[model samples]
Target: MSSRPRRPAASSSGVHLLSSTRVITALVSAAQLGEDDLVIDFGAGPGTITAPLARTGSRVLAVERDARFVADLRRRFDDRPRVRVVHDDLRTVRLPRRAFAVVASIPFAVTTPLLRRLLTPGASGFSRAELVVEWGLAKRLTAARPRDLESAWWSCRFVLTVRRRVPAECFTPAPRVDAAHLAVRRRSEVDRRTSSILWAVLSAAYARPSAPARVSLQGVAPRRITHRLLGGLPAAEVPAAVWLALAQTLAADRNVIPPRGMP
Candidate 1:
């Protein structure tokens, strides 16, 4: 996005800072920004990572909602054409159109929502994200190899990784719990719209995990894949790849026969 003259949006006082310089170095090093890369410093409070990001030769868009922080950022990078300070709420603002990397210590409350926006499948222009967020969420994002139902769907979209643990003291008003840096790598695109829809089925199944997989999948899985011929297979009994590759597609096939046996 082009650099525009911005006015302060609001006064800044209460904001979290990724205070340690070592962490900043780690984040930037991991981002491995290129000269042509467009990087977003989301919730760029007082431009903590902005200066270093600019020095990396990549164009930086520092978005801070607070007017005071915006003013501070502009003043700090007054002569640096590479850094454009934007005064807008991170949630409502439109991100850049070009492929980009994000390295930010954003508002912890908006962590999931922000991720939902940038990491949604078909969400173009995002190559990767290295964000400092709540520890529990970071763990969940990278927990399983295929992770959860959400990650399974995202597996078609991006790679998720949990980096170093960040101490709670890294902020002004320190959080009660610890934090961590989570990285997301974009996956190569393919025709996975049907597979993507299967994620909703998986999410519903997992929502009541204690229920037998057969019972959980009953409403979502097609009868051809669930009948007596297929037997009484529990949800846990079936591999997700089967759901992605067979169930739906097989349901559409006219020549296929439903199983005749029961579990």
Candidate 2:
């Protein structure tokens, strides 16, 4: 219940209080958290979702990048022991090595990077954590569009549930298009290390086979490797050890085609 209006909803930019609070409520209910759980609310604008999340008796960390919003939150919930307001950008902020749930209101920008870091290897990914995020499904990404999300295929187990229509009037500065909520959870146990390892191996395979070349500053960046780019893997990069591990990972789905021919 912090009554603060932040941005506009895509449906109609009428400046209503951030109604996206409901999305947070849905996420909490779905997670069925316990007292020992830690719930993170990234991009917490003015503690709307943060305050409610704290009521669940779980330790809540509300992360906001804006300085003004941070000061306001500190003043609003200073006495709440269950809540801690962090004034830092989530992209660079080092999240706790463990948490029960991670949720966000889905700012239009940075969704891809957020997913990449959360799904990436090491301690950064949401190991054994439930993740809930909201996104705009109405916008279609074309190569002509500045940013293309077509290459990003959601995990098979992930599910998208559309909520009530959110009007543009919901925010201060309305976005150009309408938005929808996407609730995503990994149905199976996934090894974060394996995911990262696959990313590295598959990316190297997709690069065009050209060699005996000097170290070029214009070399392809490490992040370009995606599921779409896995088909054209280089033969030299496919070692036995890496392939064996990949085979085990892909064995669960027999239809999977290895980036490299089976040795």
Worst 10 residues of 2 by lDDT: 141-150
- Give the TM-score comparing model 1 with the true structure, all chains together: 0.74
Per-candidate local distance difference test: 0.69, 0.49
lDDT of 1 by residue, 114-163 (tens): 88778764546878988899998887666433435555455435667788
Over 1-263, each residue of candidate 2 has an lDDT whose tens digit, in order, gives: 34343332323322222455455566567666678988887777766667667778888888888787789888877887888899888787777877547755646566667665664333443533333332344232111111211122123212333434455544436555555544555434334333443343334433433321111101322223222223333323333333324424554554543343211
lDDT of 2 at 247: 26
**Cα-based RMSD of the predictions, in order?**
7.3, 9.5
